[model samples]
Target: MGATDRLDRYQPLVLGLFRIVIGLLFTSEGAATLFGVLDRDATPAGDWPFWYAGVIELVCGLLVLLGVLARAAAFFSSGAMAFAYFTEHQPDGLFPLQNGGLAPALFCWGFLLLVFFGPGSLSLSGVFRRDAAPERRG
Candidate 1:
């Protein structure tokens, strides 16, 4: 097959992989929040932000995992990571290693990638394209 055909055939695989990986990562985090596995209230803020973060992670992660609205989910998840990095992780600066804080920065990078690249062409988003072809303009 030609390059175009090959890529088209495997596009779903690529997108699906991205969705699954990111989804699982966020999903586990959400599980942590929903279960209260961590002592969030121990922090000075008393876990107020943790609740919001947990909800976002849980919902967005599941949406992506299900391949439903993967693009939008990924975008918002990226934004969530950005908030974590700037406010919580990066208060000191980009040097995450300085304070054992690479997790948030890494999450931010992953989410940013998801936002720009979009959940690939193999995601539920891709299925939507095939099933919901837009009306052609005159």
Candidate 2:
């Protein structure tokens, strides 16, 4: 097989690993900001917007990580990143590089990709799927 064929054969594995890493990183950010882990100050108990965003991040991140309703979770996560970038970063400058919006920008696109492509084979969704036919074959 050629390089493309070899890569295609491992697509599910690569996608799963990518999803896991993204989910973990996103979840860690929420945990750090929400609970004061990782030397970051917690969003005060009643700060509704930030607190709620963190909650969404944490929940969606976990869902994506577990591949449970992953596309939906990824859609929401992508929206959150877009909202954060536009509201917080865009106000400072038009470009991500100028405004330090790289993280949100990257996350927005990454989750958007997941929303379209899905969580892949090594996921709870795959295990619990009712359909007997496989979605892909190598």
- The lDDT leader among the candidates is 2
**Superposing all C-alpha atoms, what RMSD in Å does each candidate have to the true structure?**
4.7, 3.5
Give the alpha carbon lDDT tens digit for every residue of 3-47 in model 1. Answer: 999788877578678778878888878767766555532223236
User: Which window of ten consecutive residues has the lowest lDDT sum in model 1?
Assistant: 37-46
Q: Return the lDDT, model 2, position 106.
A: 93
Segments in model 2 whose C-alpha atoms lie over 4 Å from true places: 130-138
- What is the alpha-carbon lDDT for the whole of candidate 1? 0.74
Clashing pairs for model 1 are 12-122
TM-score of each: 0.71, 0.90
Q: What is the lDDT of residue 50 in candidate 2?
A: 79
lDDT of 2 at 9: 90
| Predicted structure 2: lDDT | 0.89
Model 2, span 39-135: residue lDDT tens: 8999986586678778888899999999999999999999999999998899999999999999889989999999989998788888888566667
Candidate 2 residue-pair clash tally: 0
- Please give the lDDT score at residue 63 for candidate 1: 84
